[model samples]
Target: MMRTFPFGTAALLMLFCSIVSGAWLGLHPAAQKQADLTFWTFTKIHYDPYTETIPTFEQQHHCKVDLQLVDTRAVTSRLQAAMLSDVDVPDLVEIPIDFAPAFFRGPLEHVGFIDLTQRIHQAGLWDKMVQARFAPYTSRGHIFGLPHDVHPVQLAYRSDIFAQEGVDVSKIKTWDDFIRIGRKLTIPNKRYMLELYDFRSAHLEACMFQRGGGYFDPQGHCIFDNDIGVQTMLWFVPLVAGPHKIAGSIGSGQILTQAVEDGYFLCLVCPDWRSKSIEKDIPRMAGKMKLMPLPAVTANSRHTSTWGGTMLGITRHCKNPDLAWQLALHLYLNKKELGKRYEGTNILPALRAAWSEPSFSQPRPYWCNQPIGALYAKLAPDVPFQYTSPFIATAKDKLGEALVACVQYYNANGDNGFEPFVRATLKEKADQVRALAARNPY
Candidate 1:
């Protein structure tokens, strides 16, 4: 049950004083003419709760919001062009946590984005907003963006199938053990364990972190080619050709939603925020699909990793950044307004308090009545700040090409080709980054 605080007769005077203090807070000057605030976003804004909730904000602020969908492909160059040309740049923009490092370089200076440094600190939520779980990502000891929502990886498996197969959940402990039992549960036609995409598999960062690999050290060099990287990659080879091979492994579609097209795979790996997508896209399986903690990797390790999610932010560019930040806060805190959206839309809240709400506490049977909140909280500690670089991004392109060369050795189950390609790519990136640093482009 949700708790409500009530004022007593004795405290009424105090309450009156508090209410007056709060009510007298900052009130902006009224605007007769319309003002437009341009917001650039990657997600189709209308589809996301943060996007849809803006109308209420616009109404309150008496402003018209023009939203644009910005694509990240060739993003730095596009941002550079906008900066250099002194042309159109959105008043407020969304950039993922991974790309924050690149912005730290200099592309952001010309944009006139209001430095939220002091404001966020004054709000006292600097840690919670920009420096939350992913603390390492904040550059130069200043917080920049606020989390949109977190979609940490979680387990999605068919309870009905597990029951019939007597695959005891407690028995599955490690990923290796997971593979072993998954191999046994391969009932030929019924269910063949779990499915996951070889590429974009949650394992990429999970294993990297699991084996003590940081995406970048203080020096900002990609070390994904180290032992942690090698071990992480090696873990996937078995799953690709193993006895309990995942669904659509032959082609594409290795995740829960992706495998939904065939319904051949009984289990899949997905993020906790997938409730909205699962319900809307796979309605037929409603009340049947179950959510569970990612099974353990080691007896000591937690099976969770951040995959995809975003946060809200007020760019330094906003003319009324204070009000903009307030609106951003309203979207997260206004229980009646934001709360309704979260419940109605099945979107997860990034705020810690939101989860304790009754609406969030209850379980949905379609997901096997999994203890969604409790399980997800455990994964929170492991979430890291994603790092990106011009060198790393360019290297990823080369890595994609390198995957083709690795394919032959991969097909032969040798695991030889990927390393050479990755090594060569990383060496070039390192050299390039070193030279760029020497030049000090900033």
Candidate 2:
């Protein structure tokens, strides 16, 4: 028999002790010489340009930065606990786009994060940043964090496969066009036009985002089950389950990579990270792969949306906010540092100024000489900016549940009952999220 502690008890206890120990070191005023900053991060970047810049930053400021890498799933809970306990808080940390909403639920001052508005204005960085990327980290007219990467969404397709199937990629200007082309390309159990298994809710979210539908409206009300949302689902369900059957279910992780390599799906709606992974994993796809702006809901609609990203933030508990801000500014605003990070990870930089670097416009031999970075740079600004609410985490979980339920129902009963079932379930989930948000815990 094994006993389990609550989610972050052990980690929080250790962090609290570390903070207490550090405080003890400050008992003598004469012993305090320079400030020490702790930085926590989830993704372990072995060759981070930010890490390289730290030596020079420390030399100039006479400070030391301790970079701590932790499990990705534990970050949000740990940060919340540190805020409540007021101990062992990191001076700097990275927060994912989706998680940013949850952290921004309340007043910025109460959230244990320093407001970066004045600092940004002082640095004259307003025009230098990707303006659209600012929305996710802003709440109630307060800016809490700085963007790290731009994850613009696009359609990655197999040009060879589409041509072989007698489908013209350029004719796919809308979802209807995609459906038409997809129907022709799908070969029952043999191949498909798109992947539907692991990314079902994500696909729906992308479509919703593209059509200007989000989990909440600007006033922080749940509107994910609006007319536009229902319309998107009605249009989306058939592609996955009906006679059009354009999508095939693929498992997560290695199975997905294997499916793509074997040509099980001709196209996938993805962001910058996935596109990069494809080039790295299947180098043989050289001239066969091509990227296009995501097919619009209508010919006149917007062409693209965003998917995943992260931002850097400074904690209010930091002993040296000035030094922490300096370090963060260096990491995000330094063109040389951002360019290096982009080269190593293929993560599209959130600094708008970085798009003009010569490297960003270069063609990739792995992508049929496509200027992948340049294309994403063009799409980045077009991504619709939307508000994310504190209840986004809850809404995300409920939306996923609804998606899974609807997918199973559609597979079992076919198209006859899908539209109504999906509509009703999604509406119910949206209502639940609205109720949660109305409580005003913030």
Candidate 3:
């Protein structure tokens, strides 16, 4: 071949092979490669809805999607490690509200999430979405994620219990009224008006946020020990402790459902998602439960607070951010999917336009035929902003510790000097948070 092979013959054979390969490829287009996108989420509830739309998305974009359900506790740490190591990073991820601040710890330019400010504004989403929802995902005027829900919190009460006791929930408009009426209804450890925990800060945090106080200000500075905080603690400590206690502790999951079945607590802090969970977990209690606005500190105070939330964000390492953004929109803003989600999860959409979904107006038999979606939607505008910081988790832990100390002090010394002790304890915690912030300085 080296001595006698002709270049023209070799060239002709190569051309024929190329033509055959082209013809084969034309006949079997399915063999062509597609751009692959990897997505990670923490729960099946968050993952299942996409099953309806992913096929359409793949077909339209000519891409493949690989959705992975990761454990909530492990997802954030794994994401951080993958991003830091620059290997096996997902193109899209769902970040829980509690875990969001962890990704925002470093300098703005170095944040793991891609800056989405320009894109959101360009797409007109900045105005189309609920404005308050952006507070948790924004950093230095840059937005990193799109909100997944409004999560407005309301008070879900056992109407049957209230009616049996001849109590009218309508007359109770303030926290003071709630406590006073609760005192008459509560029967020591046998039954309680509501649930709170001296060892946890969730209920306390919700109440504080309702009162326009939270762990951090808009500037990401710690303000957990502010005047409102002290006053909230002073009012809250007696509800779960002391001689005038009107609350009990009912842990979450099946324990919570069982407690409701046994009538352990008459009222629960019902965020929109919690309502759906209750409906699914104990379907028989549908007619017994009803929704009402959270009792306010003042007549003008906001009637609702936000609880749990999640957001969809694109990673900086994503090879195709434009595609990821499109996918996020497909999942989050599609009215049909949003309506379906509302029907299934009772989670209000953050997009204002989606509020008009017929599902929002339909009376849900699960909530005693109350238009629960409309109820949550009515208070959606008033839900408080949840500002975030890298120190927020730490602040929450410290707040829980302060709550415990205050409860113990009240138990030992009574309400005679409870206010001052609460103030001092909150001040110490605030100082501790400030010290940590000073060291980190983000």
Predicted structure with the largest TM-score when compared to the true one: 3
Quote the lDDT for 7 in model 1. 58
Report backbone clashes per prediction. Answer: 13, 0, 0
Could you arrange the candidates by TM-score from highest to lowest?
Answer: 3, 2, 1
lDDT of each: 0.57, 0.78, 0.88
In candidate 2, how many Å is residue 74 off?
1.9
Worst 10 residues of 1 by lDDT: 399-408
**What are the per-residue Cα lDDT tens digits for candidate 3 across 1-442?**
4345567777777877999999998888775334488999998888788776788899999899988899998899899999889988899999888888778878888899999889889999888888888889987678888999999999998989999999898898998899999999888878899978779898899999998899899888888788989988988998999888999696788888888877888999889998988888877688999999999898777889989899889998899999999999998889888988888779998998898899999997767789999999999999888888877788889999999999999989988888888888998998998888898756
Candidate 3 regions exceeding 4 Å error are: 1-35
As a whole number from 0 to 100, the lDDT of residue 366 in candidate 3 is: 66
Candidate 1: lDDT of 175? 78
Report the lDDT tens digits of candidate 1 across residue range 1-442. Answer: 1123365655776787888877766354444434467666665432466566788888888877776676755444565566566566556666654554455565445323455567667766645532433343344444456666655666677666677778787777677777777777665555556665444434455445545554555455655555665555556544544334543243432344555544567676667656566666676776567766566557877666656555455555467776667766776666555445656555555665565566665666666676555566556655545544434444344433333333334666564555665456445544554565555454
TM-scores, all candidates, are 0.74, 0.87, 0.91
